[model samples]
Target: MPHYYLHLYNDMIVADEEGLDFPDLAAARAGAIENIRGLICETVSKGCINFSHRIDIADASGEVLTSVSFGEAVRVDG
Candidate 1:
């Protein structure tokens, strides 16, 4: 198992000081998506969503492995 940090990048940088442990990068990616969805749900009550916001998944050494944009996680209709 390895620790992966999912840092949020919205209006500002929110560092994940306590990282989560996952079996692999794939699992970490899934966790990131899950987290983003939960965050979006919480923000819905705020009446605004920053689609450009993103989560940067990093390894224990702080090297970003990949990123997932809020816009990419959900479907929006006109």
Candidate 2:
């Protein structure tokens, strides 16, 4: 198990003080997406969502592994 941090970046860096344990990068990525979805859902309920915001998944050493945008967290059926 490895610890990874999920930081929110929307003109600022909202760092996660306590990192989570994930088996690997893929798992971390999925976890980040799931968490972001939950956050977006909450924001959507208030009718306030900045599509430009993003979640940055990073390693313990301040290295960004991957990022998920607010727009990507949503699914719009057209």
Candidate 3:
């Protein structure tokens, strides 16, 4: 299993000191998306959230694995 760090990025970098363990990049990515969803939900309850927020997932070596935008993680059905 490999370790991955999920950082929250918008206008600044919020690093994740403690990373998560995943079997592979695919699994890590899925986990990161779920994290983004959770943040989006929290923002929704807060009344105002910059939909431009994003999640930057990196490997243990600090290399970017993937990025997910807030708008893509959640959607309003209309």
Candidate 4:
């Protein structure tokens, strides 16, 4: 299993010091999306959502594998 770091990029850069083990990149990406959704839920009470928020998935060597935008994770209809 390889370790993947999901770093949050919102108003500030929240680094994931303690990385997680995932079988592959796809799983890591999914994990990032899930985390973003949870974060969004928590932020709902704040009365403002920043769609530009994103999570950058980085490898052990500090290379960013992919990024998941908060806007991409949820569908907003008004």
Candidate 5:
């Protein structure tokens, strides 16, 4: 199983730059949510931001993985 890392920003995830890998899209989404949960919590705790935002999913090649819509889709233009 390839490890997926959800690179998060203050606003939204860098869809085009993020790289995630999993046996399926559902798993990837689950992982991404888990990863971002901490960051989201911290941001809220500091009163920096609210609303759980996320990006779809992008491959290592910077291609938008349409199967996932949990956030902004990266590499969509490409």
Candidate 6:
């Protein structure tokens, strides 16, 4: 199974969904990124910390797939 790494401030989140089949890789990747951003925003909000940090998510190969700045993420309007 393929694995993904979501890097956060003090912890790293990993998910193994390689064996799962998807219709589109782009959609799957984008969905994964969005999910991580939501998680980051939720964590920051609950901790009352500055949701102004950037999060970097990478693949198993250590390649950065996407970067989400805190400001852009915390915004209410999409």
Candidate 2 local Cα displacement, residue 25, angstroms? 0.9
Reference-based lDDT, each prediction: 0.94, 0.86, 0.84, 0.96, 0.52, 0.53
Which residue pairs clash within candidate 4? none
TM-score for each predicted model, relative to the true structure: 0.91, 0.85, 0.84, 0.95, 0.53, 0.43
Q: 2-76, model 1: which lDDT tens digit per residue?
A: 999999998899999999999999999889889989999999999989999999999999999999999988998
Write model 3 residue lDDT over 1-78, tens digit each, in one string: 899998989658899999999999888878877988887777779687776888888999999978888777777688
- What candidate 1 gets wrong by more than 4 Å, as runs, is none
**TM-score of candidate 5 on Cα atoms, chains taken together:** 0.53
| Per-residue C-alpha lDDT of model 4 across residues 1-59, encoded as one tens digit per residue | 99999999998999999999999999999999899999999999898889999999999
Cα RMSDs of all predictions?
1.2, 1.6, 1.6, 0.8, 8.8, 5.0
Q: Model 4, 69: alpha-carbon shift in Å?
A: 0.6
Off by over 4 Å in 4: none
**Considering only N, C-alpha and C atoms within 3 Å, which residue pairs clash in candidate 6?**
2-18
Candidate 5 per-residue C-alpha lDDT over 1-78 given as tens digits, one digit per residue, 9 for 90 to 100: 654445444464453343655986668777666655655556657776444355445555545453333233222243
TM-score, predicted candidate 6 vs. hidden true structure: 0.43
Better of 2 and 6 by lDDT: 2
Clash pairs detected, candidate 5 = 15-74, 16-74, 54-71, 55-71, 55-72, 56-71
Clashes of each: 0, 0, 0, 0, 6, 1
Superior candidate under TM-score, 2 versus 3: 2
lDDT of 6 by residue, 1-78 (tens): 455554554244344434233344454455555765677766766775445455555666767766655555545666
Better of 1 and 2 by TM-score: 1
Clashes of 1: 0
Which pairs clash in the backbone of model 3? none
State which candidate has the highest TM-score.
Answer: 4
Provide the lowest-lDDT 10-residue window in model 6.
Answer: 13-22
